[model samples]
Target: MHPMLNIAIRAVRQAGNIMTKYYEKMDSIESKQKGYHEFMTYVEKETRYQMIAIILKSYPQHTIITTDNNTMHTGDQHVQWIINALDGSINYIKRLPHFSISIAIRIKGRSEIAVVYDPIRNELFRAWRGHGTQLNGYRLRGGMVRDLEKAILSTNCSFKMNPNASPYIKIIEKIFTQCADFRRHGSVALDLAYIASGRIDGYLAINLAPCDFAAGELLIREAGGLVTDLTGSHDYFYNGNFVSGNVRIVKALLAHIRVK
Candidate 1:
């Protein structure tokens, strides 16, 4: 693993420990949205505080982008840490063991590293620009499921409010009619990691943000999974939409959509 990627993995594991320490505690839960509850507990806050402090201390000049609503940076530097300190907040609040701490670094608007830690499972997924994806230091790759009729897929319902969601759904609805099964776990970070680990055959989403996908994109590619815009372009980062899977199946899924 790259030295920077090693640091990223450490940070993600540390954040996972912090978050897990507070998991399933009734006192820390709070409502955040119509369909969401949050644990913005001291654990989440302090973990991010520590992670960001560590990043700034080590890479003082690099700008940090996060989901905390606490920091923002313009497009000035060549490096940025895009993070969702606590993803699957609703699941976390419900004590469902599905949340994660997602951290990815984008250099010049392109993802170069990403680390996501599944606290409940103690599974750590990490990838660097040229290195293959890894799970606990072992190399990984997407699964070999050629037919959508035999593939397991995932998507996010939260994306429905976006402009592309309808069309994206139109494509996915077809998958439901043809694929083996589909699921929505509410965490894009984990979904991408699952693709890299071969836990899911393919994944699609609309309105995914840079912080939401940058790391996962590189990881999926490194893991030998195919990723592209729904329209078959490789420019998924800017397009805000992507469909990824085992190489052969990804090609088939991409054939189902036309988006730019």
Candidate 2:
């Protein structure tokens, strides 16, 4: 294992332990609204602080980016550690055990390592740049379903009225017609990890931050899958809209999406 990846795994696992300790006492945890339909709790802050501490201790000179502040690049720019301490905060607050801790290491602006750990399930999904993705130390591969009718897709949906809601719903309806089913999981990190593990055939989401899917993106790609923007391009990192799956599933999905 790479030294940096080892440190990341240590940090994420420590953070996951913190979250698991708090998961059992949801009623006592207080949460505040961070944005429209977004919530934050002390668990996130504590876990973030713990993970950062562990990481900076190992590499004090490396740049660290979190969801709270992604643009502040002060430390060594050559290596960046992007972290989402609690990927599904809303679900955590609601006692839904489907959340994860996502950590991605980008060297020279290219993702080199990724780790997504689910504490409740005790499943660790990790990947190196050239190595394939793994779940609990076993190699993972994306689903082989090439046809949409045989695929089960995952996505994140917002109930609040927003400009993109109508268009997003329309796209979902169109895909629903062809796909076997859709699952609206609150965690994009887990969704992408699922794609890598073959739990879901594909995933699509709009308006997400890099912290949300950075780790999972690398996982999918390393696991013999593809990740691209809604337009079937490699601009998802900038556009914040991505569709990920095996090559055939992703191409089929792009064919159904009407990108305007």
Candidate 3:
């Protein structure tokens, strides 16, 4: 195992433990706003402190880009750890079991390694840039469902973001009408991890951050899936909008999204 993978492994496990504690003690939890979401608490802050300590202690010079604390990074470090200390904060706050601790380390901004763990489920999903995706320790690869109509799809919807006032709803509504199934799980990392394990056929998300999809990108690709922005561009980390699946459905989904 790469040394950095060990670091990611430790950080996510520790974060998960901290989350479980908070998950069990909801009455004492506090809430704050981050972006349009009205939720955040001590667990998010404390776990980040712990993760940063672990990652920085191992590689003191490594920069971090994270959603928990919004610490901006600058300079030419070869390693960057993109972290979402609590990916499903709202679900976590509600005592739902879908939350996860997500970590993905980018080498010069291209995430080559990732770990997404859900302590409640004892699920640890990982992927190296070239190595195949893994669950616990088993290697994983995706299935080829050539036709989109037969494929199961997953996404995080934004009726609020669109508020019946945007054009994106039509795309997902069409997907709902055609696919074998469609699920709306609040956790982006887990949703992508499921795609890697062949538990789901494909996924797309609007406005995914670097941390949200970093670890997931590797898992999807390593699992014999391809990833690209809706425009078919390899600029997902910047564009923050992308699709992933067996090669057959990838383009069709992109076409459905009408990405250039």
Candidate 4:
């Protein structure tokens, strides 16, 4: 692992430890709503703080982007650390074991290192731009299934972000008819991680924040898959509408996705 990637692993593991502690006391953690289906907890705040603190200790000049808007710090350095200390707060609050911590380092607009840690599963998915993606320590080469009718697609649209359900619903309707089945695991970061690990063959979602998919996006690309917007563009970071999987399935999914 790269030194910075190793540091990220340590930082994420520290956050995971905090999460495990809170998992045993979910009833006491107070949470507030940010939107209809969006929420946060004191644990999320502390986790973000812990991650940034650990990261800044080594790269004090690097830019940091977390869910906390107040912690946004800009510097002359070219590296940026994007983090989501608690990726699935809703799931975590419900004592579901599907949440994760996402950490990624971008240099000059390119994601060079990425890590997604699922404490519940003890699965760490890591990737570097030119290097292959890994789960535990085994490298992934995407999924073996290429037929659209047999592929399992994953998404978060069922949660219905932004109340603009029409676009998402229409696109999903088309996908449901072709793909074997679909999954909504509540965590887009983990959904993308599943794609990298070949647990799922494809994934799509709209209105995703950069913190949610930045790391997993790199993981999918490094695992020999395609990551692109619904219109088949590489500008997923800007639009937050993305589809990713093995090249064949991604291409087929794009055909059924109506990019309104």
Q: How would you encode candidate 4's per-residue C-alpha lDDT over 1-260 as one tens digit per residue?
A: 69999999999999999888877766543333333133346678788889988998998898988863234767645898999999888888788889999998999988999999999888999998898999999998888788999999998887454557886887888889999999998898999999988899999888888898999999999999999998999999898888999999999998887444
Clashing pairs in 1: none
Residue 85 accuracy (lDDT) in model 3? 87
**Most TM-score-accurate candidate:** 2
Error of 4 at 166 (Å): 0.5
Model 1 Cα lDDT, one tens digit per residue, 130-168: 878898889897787888889999987554556646766
TM-score order, best first, reads 2, 4, 3, 1
Q: Report lDDT per candidate.
A: 0.77, 0.87, 0.80, 0.86
What residue pairs are clashing in model 2? none
Candidate 4 worst ten-residue window by lDDT: 29-38
TM-score against truth, every candidate: 0.87, 0.93, 0.89, 0.92
Alpha-carbon lDDT of model 1: 0.77
lDDT of 2 by residue, 13-64 (tens): 9999888887775554243334313334667888999999998888989999
lDDT of 3 at 157: 70
Candidate 3: TM-score? 0.89
The positional error of residue 124 in candidate 2, measured at the CA in angstroms, is 0.4
Q: After superposition, how far is residue 213 of candidate 3 from its true place, in Å?
A: 0.7
Give the CA lDDT, 0 to 100, for residue 258 in model 4.
49
**How big is the positional error of residue 217 in model 2, measured in Å on the Cα after superposition?**
0.5
